[model samples]
Target: MISGSIVALVTPMNADGGVDWAALERLLELHIEAGTGAIGAVGTTGESATLSVPEHCEVIKFCVDSVAGRIPIMAGTGANATREAIELTRAAADAGADCCLLVTPYYNRPTQRGLYAHFRAVADAVDVPQILYNVPGRTAVDMDNEVVAELATHRNIVGIKDATGDRERGRDLIARCGDEIAVYSGDDPTAMDLMLAGGKGNISVTANVAPRQMAQLCALATAGDREGASAINELLTPLNSALFLEANPIPVKWAMAQQGLIGEGIRLPLIVLDEQYHADVRAALEAAGV
Candidate 1:
């Protein structure tokens, strides 16, 4: 039952473009202390595509070691190839991650049957909990509700990170698969609404910068505190929206640097936040009192 504000954590990097293990340790400690419900590494926010296989495994292992059972760590082990996904997932299980977040196959655009086979293969191969990630916007292959329902029957396929942001679809999935799957919102903007509609929690990008507030919001929404959640969400809405001024972690990394959480160095192909967007992000931070 992985639920609540599970942060898709950013991998900290130094000016020389190396994985800053010390900074990563500090970030892990900060999240655990701040009451983050779970931690996910090497997801979109962590720049998974750019990282080599060894770096990916190293990051997952580092997160598992750093957390030391303080919190659940869900490592991103998704790939376009089924064999690759299984390999990464097996490595994560070996690294002691509590679970793995498997995003839909990207670029390859596998069919619904292919999607089922893909997830089923990983669940069968790995001896760990698995959460399906259906963010078609990034993967370009939407995992339909029927496919998800089909996968829910697998023992190790425990849950899903639903970034679809479609309340009707989310509600329908909850209605049909309520007893089988735990549905988590992967989109920050509609997280409260999703929770109100019977979602367990959020796998939130916004939580990276505002863990306490995000956790509080999820708690309030899950506990039926709609008024309290709404008030807090109003305060956080700007930060949530601004964090996407560029593709994910670019702006998120920038937000972190503003708070002095990490250095400003982002990897190649994904440059630093453009100077033009600084004022907007800064204002959003101030508005949220970050």
Candidate 2:
């Protein structure tokens, strides 16, 4: 089972917004050595929104090569356009990705019917395993549980990364679809609770700095040891909230830089973490024992 702390890894970049290929390899090796369960390359945290299509594919190929079968690799092939998403997913499959984490199309706010059609189109088009990403807060459209259950029946649609952080909804989703698909927590704070309720794993941001802890937590929670998992979860609570101290990769990129895991570069439209949040993020990292 591909169930554990799958880090939504941040792609390393230079301050000038150039893709730092050297730094990228270092980040991949760090996770592989730290025992991270899987890697989600070029997703939101990797600045996927800012990269051109070639750059996006380039990053995915680099991740696939850098990891070299050491760990599972899920490429961020989601796009606002169904055709574009299908094209990217096909390319990722060609690049040897284990699966594709396709987010709900953003900006256009596709309906439940549209969402189903969008994903089904890709599933029919690609033979690789596919994980649906439902982050309504970012995508503007919330895929209802029924929609997810419907999609779960597809041969190639394998699982979902639910980012809503709503436990009740997550539980219902699992009850409806768990037998057919994997239910992964995309929100770090509630991830343990979701796992305790039978979530398969966490596609985590907190794992960026606390991989070993998150991996342990996932193992414990998946194994039904709530007390042990919660102990680690409580310790990681500060980081769960603090990482969003700014928009995603902004704060995470900064945290990674602090530990010298990656350079402090971020793309424009998004910048480095604000000065005010620096000390707070640092304190949170310290609290997580990073």
Candidate 3:
């Protein structure tokens, strides 16, 4: 089980909107020192959509190299196009990522059968461990738990990152899959609850700035120490809410920049965090001890 607090890391960029290689290495080192369980590179938070294929592959490669086996890496290799997803997953595996996180095919909104087939195809093609990412809010397509259960049987499909933030859905998925597959919470706000309820871990955006706290919360929750975990989670609630004040990585990138974790560059189609929300986010970060 790829369990614990795994960060959906952001791609640091320069003022000109290019990847900041130095900052990327700095962020990786911070996570390593803070005991982050795993790193999910080129994820939505990492702005995978805007990056070209070569850039995407390079980011994952750079992350794999940067982590230096200090922690596991779950490379984001998903694409709405099945073939592209397969190729990325193959590349990630070749680059020595421990696993691949493949999100549901977006825009086209494929049927449940198509979702299963899509994931299965990638798993079969890559021969690498795969984690199904179902963030319907972003992808416009959700992989039903039934389909997830079916895919859980595939040899290489090991788990699902349920980002729906629905406690019932998380519990149901965990129940249905049993021990065959792991259930990870992709939503930070509800992560502790899901972990206490049988989730194997959290693929967290909040962990980008609050890695140690997130890691500690995951440990408590995974141990079924509900009370202990809840205490830690209370400290993080503000951060969880604030990071999504805008469509993620926007607010997160700004907060990280303020903390000197990364530079202030965010690409187009997605702008920097709005000024109006700055003070509130700053307060949240201060409150969370981030």
**Model 2 RMSD vs true structure:** 0.7
How well is each residue in 196-290 modelled by candidate 2, as lDDT tens digits? 99899999998998988999999999999999999999989999999998889788889999998888989899988899998899999999888
As a whole number from 0 to 100, the lDDT of residue 130 in candidate 1 is 95
lDDT ranking from best to worst?
3, 2, 1
Per-candidate TM-score against the hidden true structure: 0.98, 0.99, 0.99
| Per-structure clash totals for the candidates | 0, 0, 0
Off by over 4 Å in 3: none
Give lDDT tens digits, candidate 3, residues 177-252: 9589989999999999899999999999999989999999999999999999999999999999999999988999
RMSD of each: 0.8, 0.7, 0.7
Q: How well does candidate 3 match the true structure in TM-score terms?
A: 0.99
- Give the Å shift of residue 280 in candidate 2: 0.8
In candidate 3, which residue pairs clash? none
- List residue ranges in candidate 1 displaced over 4 A: none
lDDT (Cα, 0-100) at 185 in candidate 2:
97
